[model samples]
Target: MKGFITDPLQIERESMRIIRGYLQQDWTEKELKIVERCIHTSGDPTLESVIRIHPQGIEAGLKSLQQGAPVITDVEMVRAGIAKKQLSQLGGTAECFLSDPRVADQAVELGITRSMAALRLNKERLKGAIVAIGNAPTALLEVLELAKDPETRPALVVGIPVGFVGAKESKDLLWEEHPELPSITILGNRGGSPLAATCVNALIYLAVNREI
Candidate 1:
């Protein structure tokens, strides 16, 4: 039997080492951290195949966080998972709009999903902010539509909603229709709040360490 591993730092180090063994190609240090965290969060090594990163996504996200950009999330779970301390140390903050009263009211009034409504309500704040969507594909769709308007463009979008319905389609649209947008995403329906949060946290770590 294996001995108990009580050190959290050592646990993480060992986990990353295991994940590294699964990766065949060599990725940059920053890119490897992002991938490792995703695998660590999901415990699925095959996830590496679906991950897609815009060439400038990491650098853009890091720059935004360093400049004190707000990080917007589609779900509270994602917001809660972010390393807020590290983010604050780098002059950034994370927020989730799903619980906003305005979003609830608007969803009912507009006959849209609360996630979609939430994104619409926060359109102004999304500009130049790092947007992370880990639930509700409708939210990702809304973000893409809003991004078409220059004033609502985000610094970097981490699109990884998980579901059977719109999740795959939403990510496909983000990758295909809006290739110009700075973003990171999993290509199919294999994503969730944890994966999205992991991506943002990796970027924050990169920013905090001045690696970007």
Candidate 2:
């Protein structure tokens, strides 16, 4: 949100503080470029100019600011990044932009699975309980009890795997079948612990914190 053209050193200092953890991500450089360009090109508007910048540009600007570099932004590029049709289709309420359906569905299903695992502690290495098969009902009871604790809940969950085989069906299941939950579905197929989890966890945290 902070947009200005200060010395490169100052810019880097601010970026370090604002994007402390994400500075290592792959998109950090792109973001830095965008920010630097936007600020330098737009002159000095402070907060009143309502300067528009792409998400990537904003990110780049932030990074440049953090790295203490001058930013020169292209407003046209930022405008192009906005998905007008997609935004209209979702009524500006949802963030699901994936063309593949399975990817979206997998996100929801994965979250459910993770939440269940966290609730039941179903993994083999779990340290909670050691009971026989006959004690199944008791274990279920314990799981229900633990689910009440807020700390154990999943903070966020996301799925944006590219080339998702059944993305359409999965997305339908979430939006059409179960629409109560707050979720974010992505497009493409490149998922793992860091990016996907980061997005999901951030979303969950925001939802829990009432940001979404």
| Predicted candidate 1 versus true structure: per-residue lDDT over 110-211, tens digit per residue | 999999998898799999999999988999999999999989999999999998999999999999999889999998888999999999999988887833
**What TM-score would you give candidate 1 relative to the actual structure?**
0.95
Colliding residue pairs in candidate 1: none
Q: How many backbone clashes does candidate 1 have?
A: 0
Provide TM-scores for the models. Answer: 0.95, 0.24
In the order shown, the candidates' Cα RMSDs to the true structure are: 1.8, 19.6
lDDT of 2 by residue, 12-50 (tens): 556544443333323344333422332333232231122
Can you give the lDDT of residue 159 in candidate 1? 98
lDDT of 1: 0.91
Instruction: Mark the regions of model 1 whose C-alpha exceeds 4 Å error after superposition.
Output: 210-212
